[model samples]
Target: MTTFEILNGAGADGDQLAGSLNDALCTAAPMVERISGMPLPSHVTVRLLDVAASQALSVVHLGLVYGMAAERLDTEEAFDLAGKLAATAGSRFRMFERITWPLQLGKILYGPTGPELVVVPAAHRAARTSTRQQTVVMGHELTHLAQLELWPDMLTAGPRLRIKAKLTGQPTKSLPVIAPLFEGHAQFVHRDLAAELCGVRARRRLPGEAAPTLRYRATDWLGAVPPLSMVRAIYDRGEKFVSAVMDAGGRSLVHGLFTDEGSLPLLPELLKPELWLARHHPVPAHNAHDQ
Candidate 1:
């Protein structure tokens, strides 16, 4: 079992809000381990940021560190970029506070010590969601923390996909190859954790709801790189696909099958999980349903 610490800076409701999230993530941690068969880090931290600090952190910390190259920006680039984002970030801050919903609620950041999970207490200071919704969101984020533990060296689709788009000269055209699985894996574990905790599965989409996708329209000086926000949107796909894969393969998807550096799915396979399923989990037809 894994234990966690909660750091609350979300204002007056911060303690109450952080208490709920701490309870949710702490309760959900073992369930994530059970579903994935991967032991999460022995300890983790979840920080609840108020509206203002969340925006600043998003502008500076996320802006500087996330890029295609394994190496981060040099000092000159970091300072210059930081300044530009800070200047324009006023507009973006309003957007995050008013518009963005759950993505603004929870995310994981890595640093010298280890992975850190930070989240907003509410959509804004004035609005706080129900306890259950907070648990669902925390479960999703906790799964991400588990993913980080399982695949310590793995980078998500955003950076590598961006660099590939640049090289191929097809930013808008290329499909994000790794996103479905990488995100799907987290979503599957998260949703399953939700099911276990709540006794209801949110697997089906309501009528007319669009299937989630990673839309890739190029922008900024770097045409290939997706803006910070869209990075979160892309991972919302593959919950169903992951469920199908796990169903066909076994009770729980093999965390290693996807996490293993040597045997990870290729580009086409990620786009169509069926291809990945067939390649990695070659179940006999008669036994397919049973698995």
Candidate 2:
């Protein structure tokens, strides 16, 4: 059994929206578990934030948390970083403004307390709050919940790697491999859940379509290196890798890869999505009801 608490932010409609989102999350949990081969926690907290709150969180996360991590700054240094961020927030407001809208509808964050999913309901108003879209977004965030519970290391790999580099004087490794695996796995689970629950089929990309050019500043931290476009590649390439894995071995194979940390493929192996598909030999489609 699963449960949720909605932290409504400063409005009456937030409660209703949070309730609806809670229902979507409940509906998505079992299917997400089935597809990802990881069980979700019995309880989850969903926070509904309006545009202002959402933008604030993004600024703090991107400017403060990410900046501190990337530079490995000390407390004194953090104040300087905070000052720099505050100074630029005015000019960069337009650039960072998208966080309040559809570009960032939901986020799954884990801290000392536990895991929480934060979403901006106002972000989805442009789409008139389509149930299918909401379901898909919920499913995506829920997959992150599953990852945090099951493979917490994957989510924190960046900071761990950075610390390792600082301590050992070794070169810091970018999340080229890790981010894709995490984001890709979430993307796959999202699509799988959508198919199972909403009868939506996975969208296939045309040749060359998977790697479109994306814009991002060099200084921006997007949970990985090369900022935005590379981050997008992580999703695009990751989905392809996950799809191939699922086609070849079904959910069991995915479960094996996810659970066995040591056996995870390296960057070279991950780069060749075609090889994985060829090796796995596509299996028949799964009947969602069977799970």
Candidate 3:
């Protein structure tokens, strides 16, 4: 059985809020496993961040964290590669004008110490408070926790090594390929759980909801990628890709992609919705959203 610890930073009502979140997690965990075909971690931590803390961390993430890590490269080759990436990122950042920190409801992050799921209370409170929303968000973050647990390397060496290799202009083996699959599969699980528990389709026809026509350019700097639109595209497009896979081959296929890198779909293949539908029989439960 998995256990969760909540580190609430909201001051007043923090404990009470943590309790609510804990209950939400408890209720959602089984559904997450059922939908994702993955097990939850034996132990997990959830952190609650108020708006100010969320903003401050976002600053650190974009500026000092990535930038300083880039500066610590031992080799001249790595330094030069980091510089080039920084230049490209800087130009993109300028055009976007501080798009790095969008108002997010929650995020799963790993630090030097360990991995934790962080949620913005202000943002979550602003949304319509419903059992469905709570279940979906909890299910989503829990799916991330499960991914990190299953791929312990992703938590331990994968991120730092991936960054260093990219900074040194070396080959990045799986992070870029694995990332969308990770998020897409999480999104699939979240939606599936939402449908089962809440009796509603999680997909929404919001702005920027259109599927991608072309594949995203492969880059090691996905973490530092500046375009908010492009970032949104990655999640949106990735979710659709996971949905197609689930529709075609069910949860097991999506789970296989996570557990085995070789089973993962290529970026171009994910971009083509028509191909997925033509080849694989769609899952009836998953296809209910269209009707």
Please, what is the whole-model Cα lDDT of each candidate in the order they appear? 0.59, 0.63, 0.61
* Candidate 3: C-alpha RMSD after superposition: 10.0
Worst 10 residues of 3 by lDDT: 211-220
Return the clash pairs for model 2, or none: none
Give TM-scores for every candidate, taking all chains together and pairing residue i with residue i: 0.68, 0.68, 0.66
**What value does the lDDT take at residue 278 in candidate 2?**
49
Q: For residue 286, what is the lDDT in candidate 1?
A: 72
Instruction: Point out where model 3 deviates above 4 Å.
Output: 13-16, 58-103, 155-176, 203-229, 262-264, 273-291
Query: Clash pairs of candidate 3?
Result: none
**Candidate 2, residues 1-291: lDDT per residue as tens digits?**
668777888376575576667767778778787777788888888777887776666555444443444354445544454456544653465464553244565786542245578887765543344455567778888888787776655544554444445455765442236667777888887877767654665532223323212322122335344444565687878888877777777777776666656545556558886555544454467899977
Count clashing pairs, candidate 1.
Answer: 0
Off by over 4 Å in 2: 10-13, 58-100, 166-169, 172-176, 202-230, 274-291
**Tens-digit lDDT track for model 1 on 43-106?**
8877777757776665444443343232333345534544444445445655754444333567
Candidate 1 wrongly placed segments (more than 4 Å): 72-98, 101-103, 124-128, 164-176, 203-236, 251-253, 261-271, 283-291
